[model samples]
Target chain A: MQYTSPIREPLVLQGKTYADVTEDICRQVEAAPNPRWLGAMFLSLLALGWGSYTLYRTWWYGIGEWGLNKTVGWAWDITNFVWWVGIGHAGTLISAILLLFRQKWRTSINRAAEAMTIFAVLCAGSFILMHMGRPWLAHWALPLPNTYGSLWVNFNSPLVWDVFAISTYLTVSIVFWYMGLIPDLATIRERAKNPIARFIYGAMSFAWNGSAKTWARYEMVALVLAGLSTPLVLSVHTIVSFDFATSVIPGWHTTIFPPYFVAGAIFSGFAMVLTLMLITRHVYKLQAYITLEHIESMNKIILLTGSIVGIAYLTEFFIAWYSGVEYESYCFINRAFGPYWWAYWSMMTCNVISPQFFWFRSMRRNIYVTFALSIVVNIGMWFERFVIIVTSLHRDYVPSSWTMFWPTYVDVGDYIFSFGFFFTCFFLFAKFLPVINIAEVKAILKSSSAPSVIEKEEKVKAGVKLTPSYNPKSE
Target chain B: MTKHEETHKFLVGIFNDEDILIGAIKKLQAAGVKLHDAYTPYPVHHLDEYLGFKRSRLSKAAFLFGATGAILAATFQSYVMGIDWPMIIGGKDFIAPPSFVPVTFEFAVLCASLGMVATFLVSNGLLPWKKAVMFDPRSTDDKFVLAINLADNKKIEEAKIVELLKANGAEEVNTKEIKKK
Candidate 1:
């Protein structure tokens, strides 16, 4: 019988002092010019100017300058809104949900994922604010009391709920991410040579001292906040789901929305994470920290979430027919075979069929394939939102109100700017923050590096004791 | 005081599984031995209750911090947008609840998070303390340890400790005695 010792090292990578790890990351960042710096800059510039021009046109004219009319009151604008919201989900899920599950791989990827959630949500808000015919008058949607010109805001409106949800999610995320960064910040603070770098990291570190007691309490607090973040993350998407689920549109209102929307969010979110991570791994050359195993794990999540979203599509179709409502049935049928049939099929192919490749180990492990699939998944999710909003709203109750709505140049430009916003923030975050948690990684290393004296002594003692006890048995 | 005057013994029984550790703690509790501390690399569920820990008041911290945020945000928004400036747009009232909720919730969460972090840092005395010389670095890696100081209880003797640890399925026994120079 094997007698197992109680004391052992579970963390695989340990003993990497803050200096070693930070140097490694800095060295990587410094040595590489991001390979595509010029390209990224050029594209970003092109998109920025074009996106600015698009907005300038929209502001100069009106929201009416685009293709939206009465029946199809929402078009690419709301579609982008939902798309960005869905994209935001993957980050929080990686950081919070994976943390709860004790998935160690999450440590490598969560910082970037959390950053993505914040930026994507911001991009999403841009859509809603821009969608408003009178964007400046948007403050009226808020609830202030009378006399001070404060009016009671209706809690019933999903838009009102959204003001709470997105704001809460972003703030909570900032705290969670910052807390994780504190120890790492201290690490960077210690290692930094330059005055500016030293000051920046020092302020961010907030005088973090790596004491045992501090770690105990910090871990406790982090776990508790992680617990709080879990529900908040789920709620943000569920509330976003409610925007469509609560509406009276025949196709929009459904019981499956909350879970379905959540699933779709994760699917799209993972794809974006993979896409960025793929570029980052190549750009910064962080192959060791962001390993193939980590990519495989993310791919697994993408597959699972994608499958869940796929099942939702099937369920929605079956239920639409099973419920036997003509309008609902027609909505589903029109989605599959309507004027926007190409868009609907594209969504299905990108979301459901494409992710199926991850079932193969080769595809999941391949950086290029994973990166390509992620982009496909993102595009598919965007179209899914478009189909849901445009198909239902475009062909509503009255036939005369039905019109094919298309995106104008302004619509297209904002779409490019949305990427501009996402990439710009992500690039800045990568350059500044410890993208992979340094302290947690260091803690893991410190524990794993040494085989303790206790274990060595225990082995010696066990050996001394065993000689006497096993004599009879051996004889 | 004489240095290294050997007296009583602390028998720390080691177990591979969490369930076994739990059962041992319960036995120790039942036998009325005051637990010095139990250290595990990873958190074991409900091990704290076995060791007789009170519920953490981080929740209270969260609540207080959250309330501070709510009040501060509300006051700020009310003062800035509602009373002080009073910029009216689209005939809509100022001091909007929806707008208030965002800032309030943001501030609340912010306070709670910062409060939790700051309180943790201060309470733990973590700011660049004298480096805690490691007792066993491997403890953080993957180990469950129950520390029993022999001097803590008069009832526990050296022989009895060894017997108890052996009975509780300890893999090995070793002694650590503090020396006074």
Candidate 2:
């Protein structure tokens, strides 16, 4: 019965009991695919098809499929890789960081966010495969003893750290997401009338009998995993940043890259979560479960991280000038006023400026505005990576070697394909799994004032004579 | 805890509320009935203390696994860089531990996480494809159920236990024979 936040807006509206929560979630999985679900699936499949064709072309040809000259080796490929990786951060942060902080609000959205993280990492992994034309040799990145002269992976290389960081991140995220789903999967198993579904969910449930010892152990494991994931999340992005920071390139080699990239990752990540959650809430008719409070809280975080990213942007410029290195100073100067000034400015406008609107409570509450800004923030973040990679690499100290990097049809198609991959996986996830954490929502039913108000509404539906005490205008 | 092979007769008292379940457990324990287990949809806070279970040893296991992962990663890295294919890069020593730290740390976390989950599953007999008896399906959904092993006390009559459960606010009472594997 302890409500931590002053905002009494119930996370679960409709005086929902434990049974109601389970029924609502299980119905989403069990019900026939609605038109909206079908429409989304169609779109995702189209993207997947496009991506498959593009991959074939890239593999059939070579790295020369992209419009890469002497300069700008990594334009869209690394940009998409970093963008997807950044988008993956929000899920782990919501699940692990919020759990450690005892923020109960995370319970509603953590399941979907964790799923997003796994999917985003997969998208990032795909880019890595595509970036290496011969993805069959992808296993060479591992430290397996090779037959050729007993050569091993260079542990000192940041790329090696990347392989470990990304693979480990994906594994832990999957395990964490699956662990949280066990109880709910058991609920689905028991309720499922369909034999095939019953069989699949039954086996997946691991025969969870809901015994007291099992619940205790479940909580312990969740806590330990959360503890492990918190530091692991920080390290994943920090290691990712090392891919740039370890480089000798003028814009890439900076100590500020780690914290800067982490903040940017989180900022963009929350935006992506909001974008997806808004659609999910609307599509699934889960307004009571998702609520404006959850959305507003996420916005506040976006504002905070966005501002941090802004400060980092400014700090990077200041340091470049302060460093007194002609190359570094020119890199910063050329970024703002050079040929790719439009990309740099677009990043500044979308990532740094747009998130400032969230300071107003009304803006955060406005769904349309939130959704629009979420897309804008993602666009800005992608451009930020593009500006850093393309601009920095395009113009070097040796002017004769400098060239413009323009992505060909294959590059554009591949980027679109990753979106197709991300959404395709997401559509499948939404179709099968309980999008919300049912058990955690049930735990909060008592403390939330939502059910009392919701119960009154239900009475109204039942044609009771009770006067509705809930007032929207009073609040 | 009974062995996996043992067969036991159980009297299950089901309640909808956690408070009622906790109160029932206390009363049953006071009456000298050895409680077998309680099943709940979620982890009811303080239920472990009420059941008189000791603290879990999961943290100790995590520490052991984590240390093992760290040692393995560091040793693997050292053997590769220091002995197998020694080469000078960035003008630093080939066996530089600092440079190997990130991957080593990642490998440690990866191993520890997977190991902890494996340990939990094995300990709880919840590994994939494992089967255990379910007294009532409602326990995984909405109900709080307290199970008492009738085989623990031969003198305890079934009707007496049912009457006790009814008196203590049990919504439903049932008896079942469970075969553990």
Predicted candidate 1 versus true structure: per-residue lDDT over B1-181, tens digit per residue: 8765654444455554445566777776677677655554434546666676665677678779878888987887677667666766444576666545544665576677678766766665444432322223323333345656777767766677666656675545556443321
How far off is residue A157 in model 2, in Å?
0.7
Residue B80 in candidate 1 has what lDDT? 62
Kindly list the per-residue Cα lDDT of model 2 for residues A161-236, writing each as its tens digit: 9999999999999999999998888888888898988889989988887888888888888899899899899998
In order, the first chain's TM-score in every candidate is: 0.88, 0.95
lDDT of 1 at A24: 66
Candidate 2 segments whose C-alpha is farther than 4 A from its true place: A1-8, A452-475, B1-7
| CA displacement after TM-score superposition, residue B50 of candidate 1 (Å) | 17
User: Whose TM-score is greatest here?
Assistant: 2
Q: Measured by TM-score, how close is model 2 to the native structure?
A: 0.96
Model 1 lDDT, residue B25, Cα: 71
Q: Show where candidate 1 strays beyond 4 Å.
A: A1-19, A28-35, A146-149, A446-475, B1-56, B63-181
